[model samples]
Target: MAGEITETGELYSPYVGLVYTFNLIVGTGALTMPKAFAAAGWLVSLVLLVFLGFMSFVTTTFVVEAMAAANAQLRWRRLQNPKEEEDDDSSTASDSDVLQDNYGQAEKLPILSVQRRGSPNLFEITDRVEMGQMASMFFNKVGVNLFYFCIIIYLYGDLAIYAAAVPFSLMQVTCSAASNDSCLVEADSKYNDTDVCWGPVRRVDAYRLYLAVFTLLLGPFTFFDVQKTKYLQILTSLMRWVAFATMIVLALGRIGRGHGEGHPPLADLSGVRNLFGVCVYSFMCQHSLPSLLTPVASKRHLTRLVLLDYALVLTFYSLLSFTAIFCFRGDSLLDMYTLNFARCDVVGLAAVRLFLGLFPVFTISTNFPIIAVTLRNNWKALFHREGGTYPWAVDRVVFPAMALVPPVLVAFCTHDLESLVGITGAYAGTGIQYVIPAFLVYHCRRDTQLALGPGALNKHRSPFHHTFWVASVLLWALFCCFFVTANIVLSETQL
Candidate 1:
């Protein structure tokens, strides 16, 4: 399929198939979905996953419909000016020429203007509404940024804490059970003692925090700004594979080993539920929409690809979740990855630890380009030209900005891993992922197409479409409330 061309040489490639689809399947969800499952039971969690999948499906449908509507507007516009090379020849006919040929006089012909040319399609407008609504619902950029920052801080910080803590925790358990000058003590040396620092930081916590902040910087500073970043796209795709493999290996290891000393088996129903949510959210990858949209051959092709890609992603998540739950039976799904980290046998633990540690690094690398892209698109616009070049301004300004901001806030936020994950989940998840998409769909369907002429314009929306708008809006509202109250407030056993 050929791409749609703009007036300039730039081709509209929004919908590049599997690569974009892969990005959508990975991200923050991959980082913390296990936590969501840990909070809820497996049986209940699976059911919730089904519901979330349905919502995601509906949201995807809404996106497709909006894209279609926009394409239709473009088609309508093309018909009005048939000779314009920008028009997609397949969808539009030469209405003006046909009128002139048939009616003999173009002035006498009665042109039917069902819709206007160049109007914002329901989807584009809805996308704006959704973004604005998300920013607003979270209250403001400062609050939203703070909430997200806390999450990155905690997740990264905890990754460090746990890396060191796992070995120490095991040691404490071993020493308390063993006699004085025991054989286990003899086996422990500098080589095996997890405390050996390779850098200035003596503590693993600082190392991990730095790593987290480093990874966290990627998302905001460099993802956009390019017409396309094929190398970065390939890197993201590789991370997708790595995340999948690591998720499987760690999940299985934890599940099979079951539990550590004094800890219950890793099959708690609450944890299972949380895991399911995390699986759906993590594997779904909603944040990569813009990238996925690029490289689409046609609007029709893009729709088919999205539906298929989402279905496959859902299947992958379900299988992974099921395997993890079945293997580790008990209330131990909470902190699933940590269980894996803790359970790594001494013989192979070093390699396993190194592999597990790479997750945060990979996550950080993946997000850097994404953040850069976002800044270039949104913030840079205030100063720079819409499509102007700014010779590594993003690197100089945005990269440094991301590096400094999160750690500073982390210093203030207090690094409790669970609390940070929950708070970020509540604030960012509620408004950004769930609320906004639903709102955009609702607004797009209900709002009339902006008319450029003067006539009654209520014909585009039907009752069925209106119902979709209402149902989606209502569903998102419920999720928003649940996420905010349950996850953000830090109540007993809720998040």
Candidate 2:
């Protein structure tokens, strides 16, 4: 389970944790946000985005609190079972020995009574409890399975979005180049797969070909353990910074020159549903909390650290979206904003235009295999039996195959990036980002009360500790589901 404390050395400062969290929360979702803002109206989008960022920050606290509780519980169980400690020589004995010694001194103490005493060191965030591990600790079989199901769905959506995005970008740039040397900056100029890119080859065929090439190039990495090297991450981070800075500066310059053509409505009710989904997706970091928080050297200001990160991210999102909406007309903004600057005229330099156009291609291609392997490992963990080993073929091939196929097929059927992002974020992203953390915190608090007695205090408890906050998060998630579903149904009927 991912939530169990592993002995990975803590090497990062809190600042590094802040950087990682920032990077994790801002990804492909952020790129789609300006278009969402354009559609929803900037004022409405601003209010909703801030509210969503706060909600995400609240849930992140919930996850970290649960993580501390999970660690305390694991330590308590080990203290109660001294014989198991004696049997496992490879275990880290010093910490367990100190805990056992404390328990032995108060031999007549009730189980976990030491924790109930509110020992300052008892609930330390030393252990790495993955989200799945925390689910297993606090949830029953049914609840645990639900957790896995939500996560699996979210990861699948993530893969599908990545699969579609790269090929779509490639097709857009290739077709635009083949059709004319001049860039297509006009709002009404849209291309489809049925449009010709080369001699007798439609854009749709070209998309499939690119998708195939993408799969062929990156798919095999899923079969092996894919570790993202430090250099690779650093390189991608640099590209990300360059691409984002260029877009923002370009948009701001256009707006400053008074050439802005945008006149987005004050409120577009039709776009509100998708805007909610995009915001949820953009602020998501809850699923990766355990991995992110575990390596931090200190926990004293963990919540404050998270708060600052979200503050910076929200400001960045606002600046990016506002500039975009003011610079480009709502109808002209592409789903991927980088494409708007891909024109040689818009950007002037061919190299810069090419870089902007291929930005998604460079970043998403790196992520595809890593995400695919993660999905594969999650599948193995979900159905895994105690002390059971999978067959060679099943372990090596079957899981990776299952993880890679469906998303590619989805990419084949449609390249509607906005709809894909909206639907995925609305449903599974809602589950992982909002519902799961709320429930995990609720259950963890209850379990802590039962084990450590009502008087026990968890040092890492969230600032939003009231029961009302838990109910509020769940209620918000429920409302989002109903709202998104109604919008889908109404759209279908109108169609």
Candidate 3:
């Protein structure tokens, strides 16, 4: 009741803004980045990576800020439809006590259409509000929600890779308990049955089963609502920090163990290129936009925020890659920080092992919620009714169900870890990180009014600046379309 209101009378916060930005940008990709590095080769990949990061940062900065500005300047009527306006007029029985100038009665309701129930339906209040209208709206726009499904598929693929190899790695360690040969080596191979010991259960199906288990895990996760998954958000954040720490320690361990070029043969340009794509995908947390704007810093503060964010991300990525190259060279590099650290007997092994062992649990926890929410919201919007508002409850019911359904239907589609990474690289990678923001940038850059903050109606700018932005917009659009198409084709062909 006492917060800053937008033109539509919605509350805005700066805390949510920062959280949304940070969360949107980080995820499971952090765990798999090493694998990407292994494929791309450090030298060639790093250069391209730095450039990509810079482009993404700049583009994202311009687009998100501009959207905030545009939303602010629009009149309340422009934001919502006639149905919403009518709903507002009927509700808000407290209109007689208009104490706040910021409060716009007509704009209080969102740009949504609800079902016409009984007369009481117009004013019925429930403890839990339905917010699925937007979800339904989203699907209508994006065709089949394939992009959202892709995330669940990717996560399932990761689980499959882990299941296929982790147990085998453990078996090797137990069999050769006293030997120096790494248990992980046997598991890392594309082929599963290289028996270092006489009695190790090495078979092709074993690896296949591992892949199947992972896929099975993934199916259910994709079936639910993304907005409702709270545990997923927490676990992912925890995993991020854990992955970051483990990567550094593992690199040091590899270095200490005398692994040298400091990288494996497979960690080439192809591998690193793949990793770059994964990093971009994992770090994307755009869904947290509502939460990120919870804080209230001035428009002038955004430049500093962008600068700090880029610096932190770039520094972490560069150091992590360098450490990876320094510690494991050639075909010996691991796919994840956990895989790397699992080979060592260092003090950090306890934390690393726990993370590795429990990661699948945490990973599967969120995938379903994300998918269901996205779908549910899209469904509501398309139907022109209110969707479920509480994402957490929706996720609780939907996440597990989604997780279980996929594997049952597909017989747990199996894929290798690297193959999974490649799929994501070709699909979600190009669209979410590179394409969407680029399109938004191109669309918004022409109007200088967009460049100004929410108070743009009162701001001033030169006509020449608008021309400059127009040229800039065209350049970026061309680049985005070209690269998106290229990346898509190249990824599938592995070119």
Candidate 4:
């Protein structure tokens, strides 16, 4: 991909990028949100959800702003050493011919072109830098390692959740007692490991069996390079929209027919811990912003496009969760909201029930290998030296195993998707979502100004450019950490 494409009519427009970003953020978290919302109570959930969404948006701009800074930094280094310019960086803009090779050898020029308030802007965002590369650029070795640790932990939690959920859905739908069309079983929340799935097999055994199949099927992709086929993304996107629409309409339809069973409290502090994590998990799109935003040919209105996407996502989450908590009782809600409708009675049509039951299978099955591959690559990156290559065995076997084993082990131990999301989002998600970006933007700002002189402006800088916002983000992350730790300690003590 071209590193810099400031002019229009190139790859894709900002509008298309908006849709891709929306899809990225609105994944598994949305499916798990209603249960958290119900437990937390509507008033508290709504207020926290809105605040979390706003904070997420703020950090998203930080990611974008950092991306532009990464570009500028790469471009400056390239101009300094034109020979080794394209060695690691991609900011080899064709405009390097503007100055002679020894131009800045004696007395330095502006690291990047100087930008005086209304002078024609020349400090173009000339490269696409991944977050890891950005961390390496701005952070010390310890900070870089911390960033990788947070990301790896978050992805592991994601894989474990997926590993548990797909099989759990299969276990729910295939149980002979539950699946028989003759019996009108209500979507019950009392399911457990001891429940009978088939004549002799218990639900727990069936779940493990399906988990084995899922691992055998998708786990191999971690060992090889898996490029997401265009058709696969399209198919999954279609099924996802269909699944979400069906759930929302079914919930709305049930509430309309005087079958509404929900009566959640307006405020409840007991569930706030899970609710905060759920909201953070739901609004996550910061890490992948580089891949999504870089290919957009024109970034003039990129921030506006992102704003529109977040607004739409916030509205959609509110609709999905609000309808959900009101249409189903808090006590009866499942960890996976979609599972609540995976029954003949809840959804009138047999086809719809089948589709809803297998929705995670379709969408998440496709996503597993991609995430596995990504995690595997990240593990390799964390250990890589400046001029080093791993042996074939370590590269192929060790890295993939490192990526695949821990999450599977976690899944084997527990299928509690709620706690999995809560723990992951509250801690690792805090670093990636709040802490990392705040520090990245803050450091990148200092580095950029030092290089380009104070007058050098990054046109794509975040609106929350003030130092106060960065400090506030850091403080909020600290509060979440303390609050979640206290709750966990209290619960354990009680137990």
Each prediction's RMSD to truth: 11.3, 5.8, 9.9, 5.8
Query: Tens digits of per-residue lDDT for model 2 on 1-495?
Result: 122234644458889889888998989998899889988887899999999999999999999999898777766666767676355323334322221211100111122444354454658888666677677677777887788888888889999999999998998888788777766332344666687888999989999999999999999988887767778988998899899999999988888889777887788889998898889999988888877788788779999999999999999999999988888888888888899888665677778888999999999999898888888877776776645778999988899898999999999999888888888889999999889999999988888877777776888999999999999999999999899999999999999
Report the alpha-carbon TM-score of model 1 versus the true structure.
0.59
Query: What are the TM-scores, per candidate, against the unseen true structure?
Result: 0.59, 0.92, 0.62, 0.91
Clashing pairs in 2: 2-130, 3-129, 3-130, 5-128, 193-204
**Top lDDT hit:** 2
Q: Cα deviation of 398 in candidate 4 (Å)?
A: 1.3
Best by TM-score: 2
Q: How much RMSD separates candidate 1 from the native structure? A: 11.3
lDDT of 1 by residue, 462-488 (tens): 223556554665676476457556533
Q: Write the per-residue lDDT of candidate 4 for residues 104-169, one digit (tens) a residue.
A: 001112344443232114345444556776787778779988888888898898899899889877
Go through the candidates in order and give each one's C-alpha lDDT: 0.42, 0.82, 0.44, 0.79
Better of 1 and 2 by lDDT: 2
| TM-score, model 3 to reference | 0.62
For residue 236, model 2's alpha carbon misses the true position, in angstroms, by 1.1
